[model samples]
Target: MSDWKLFTDAACTEEFGGTLTTVHKTNFSDNPQDFVLYFANVAGDPGDNQVLELVEATQPGTNYLTMSIVDANVGSGHEADEITLATTAAGLDTAIAGASLDLGQDDDSIGVIRLLSGVSAAQEIHVRVENAVPNEGTSTELSSAMVEAISRTKSTA
Candidate 1:
């Protein structure tokens, strides 16, 4: 029989799960149109693995918000796809501008962006959000805009 086991003892075991960390909040501005919301793998014990969750409370504009992950450290070479938001739905919409997605209003519209690989400590995952199409609006305000990092853990049996 194998020595490996799954946790059954409630007092002696810790759950194989993820921890949520708040990364960023919206601070409205007019210029630049594009901004870096959060830089992952920079601070804290962001756990061993992670996925990004973006929440926008209000509709920023009629256009979509594009999210991309770029190389932060040379030779570390983490691979992840860019996510673009243009409408109010949950899932991938790749046909639009290098796989763009929509950022819908309210709590119901939570965008979950999964990383291609688990980010190593000190290796950065650069996240940016930009207006796909500019409008007459001077400032963008969200009722509740924030980014969260959800850590991933492994389970054995």
Candidate 2:
């Protein structure tokens, strides 16, 4: 049976803008798998126009999973939007702009993305939480960010 395995856990209270990448140790087989992210913003208020996105920070390029709002107080509301797993820079930018997650509130949200079939066994993978659109001087605090891996196992025919 396939099960979810804890890959990484991170928490921070500092205010940051732009992109933040956290590298974690993981053993991902070449088989199909999924990367699940559980994250929350406990304290502080992320501005109205702030957007949060969880991305796979690979060496050659980055893959975007979903986007959310950092502040619930924004007009957009708290909702996780799907982003196309495109490798191009313009495609990624457009995808991120279309989604938002409200992080100013106390509640948490999950974002899941499928790992590429060609993914090889690696010692570490980078997970990035980006605040693309921060409203002026406002900032948000990341209470916790957890990543879990779920792999599919094959059975002998």
**lDDT (Cα) of model 1:** 0.26
**lDDT values for all models:** 0.26, 0.27
Give one digit per residue, the lDDT tens place, for model 1 in 23-115: 222342432122112122212224434332222213222223333333244233212222222322222232232342332222223333222
TM-score for each model: 0.21, 0.24
Tens-place lDDT digits, model 2, residues 1-157: 0111113333222223333333322332221111233232222113311122222334111223223334334444221221122223333444443243221121122223333221121112222233333233333332223232222321111
What stretches of model 2 exceed 4 Å from their correct place? 1-70, 75-87, 93-96, 100-113, 116-138, 141-151, 154-157
Residue-pair clashes per prediction, in order, are 7, 6
Candidate 2: minimum summed lDDT over ten consecutive residues — where?
Answer: 116-125
What ranges in model 1 sit over 4 Å off? 1-42, 46-83, 86-118, 121-137, 142-153
